[model samples]
Target: MTTHIPAAAKIVADLKARFFPTPTYRQLQLEFDLLLEQRRANLRQGRQQEVRGLLVVAPSGAGKTTLVARVLRQHPSGLRMLTEGEERADIVSMVVPSPATPKGVGLDMLEALGYPLRRDRSAHIIWQLVKTQFAQRQVLFLHLDEAQDFSRHNNHNDRHAVISTLKSLTQSPQWPVGLILSGTPELLDLVNMDAQLARRLKPVEHRPLKTSVDGGMITAALRQYAAAADITLDDALCKPRFVHRLVHAADYCFGILVEMICEAIGEVLLAGEDILSTKSFVTCFSRRSGCPEGLNPFVVEDFLALDVRRLLQPEPGPGNQGRPR
Candidate 1:
């Protein structure tokens, strides 16, 4: 006999396929495409000039990593032969280790490029290998995700090592690969270390939205996601009050907000409901936060007076710990 699946689980399974692109996501996508195209042009021109790099900074949970990954998906990494009859990477991306040291970062890059390592080499040795391998691959572009780790808990010398290495990679008579540095705001410290480094990279900041300014956009995003999931949202739950509360609850993070909405939708699906109501959201928040109804912003009528931070994840620190790829 076949086991019956719960309606909620079935609906949530269907919702898994949905990808709601908010206004911010759209803007970032465009910027990334333009940057990628510009780099491609440089490759075509065979120009050895110093191709400018991009640094994207955002708070933890602001979706900096996800945004970059989505954009990079359009340019899949593979081997391509240069005019010089040498194999080169179309694009190479990797996450910088926590409290990233120059040597550790170098090894990470080598690993990302599919190089075998015995872990017996020094930072200097690993870097030499990296330069050689990168040259062989003719890597046109390199993306360092969670790059804030470069400066996180690092001494001045360590920080400088990482920065100088990055600079050398983009300088003339070397690889001259276009760089993409993405991480939390702490990444600015790494960029600001060298005035020249700051000048070389363009900054793309992702700041949290204020409810008063972004309420309409947030509301639209919520409605759009519900519609995509083939469900209706309650009119009350779609109002600015709910939107503001959500923004606050999510620490004004777009990524967190999207996840919270998806979780709420899942809750609604589990209940076999056709409409996303505040009650469903209340359940979602309560479950995520492990808070009673009185403290849950989605459950209480006077949610505006409640401090949602108490119920959310602990604030991010300089470490900004994330999964390693």
Candidate 2:
């Protein structure tokens, strides 16, 4: 059996080989940098205040998760950060549920922190265990990715509880835990729903990168990243041409430069005789699933719709009114 390699895939493989860990887009650099510092300091510190959480809102693929992973791995001390299995995680990270509610968010938090969750364990019991271990360890950093998923199908009351719980995690200065929350801007409205949660989270707001309009620091950063990656796409990620496509693709938020360029490279490779030109790259990237060009827009729309459903996860009926019922 022969494994056929497309031209685009070959180009992307070449690009990835050159830039294994591609630089993140410029817009998120500063915040991400600060986040790195916060994580480092949180390690081995007994009573230091953790950096406040970041509430980054952008399209789906803006490199947010990759950024967090990069920061954790790149640290000099190299303290181990593992996913939750059973035991508590002193310093752990994971994505929050869409339509974030106390229950959903709490479950994710529990799982992320490595709590031995069971139907048998009461919420009170779980809280005690988590709080005790965290306080003892002095774990100041808690990174929550895809937090926009915390949207609750229920009422304001549920949202408030979830917010309060997060706040409680940071209440004791002796055992304070700074959070990092990244997701879509709709989370802003979700925050508004729960005044106290909004008040406490004080989310360090973030917007998507722009390659065309802004050209000072952020633009320069993208150019630098492109240079590092040895990529000469007509528009840097900081430019409008690239950013616009990302926004439409709905991956402009948590997705990373590495993923985009690599995907584009794959697209270019799959383009038969087309060389690895930027046109081929972007044209291929414009479409999802590697289909023809015309179908790109609709595919993106379908994905966005899926994202909404996944994010909102509204409770059964009534919320949907009578149309479907």
What TM-score goes with each of the models?
Answer: 0.83, 0.63
Candidate 2 per-residue lDDT over residues 1-325, each given as its tens digit:
1233644455556655542332343434455456557655665564455345556555555555665566655555564565444343445777666556565556555665656577466555666666676765556567777766655354666656656667677665556666666666666666677555566554443455444543344344434434543455444454555445544444334244445545554554454432334464446444444434333432332333322212223332454321110
Q: Model 1, residue 269: displacement in angstroms?
A: 1.5
Candidate 1 — which pairs collide? Answer: 8-269, 8-270, 88-137
Question: Cα RMSD (Å) between model 1 and the true structure?
Answer: 6.5
Candidate 2: what lDDT?
A: 0.52
The per-model lDDT (C-alpha) reads 0.74, 0.52
- Name the top TM-score candidate: 1
Please identify model 2 stretches exceeding 4 Å from their true place: 1-51, 77-79, 83-90, 97-101, 104-108, 111-114, 194-196, 199-205, 214-260, 271-274, 282-325
What lDDT does candidate 1 reach at residue 217?
77
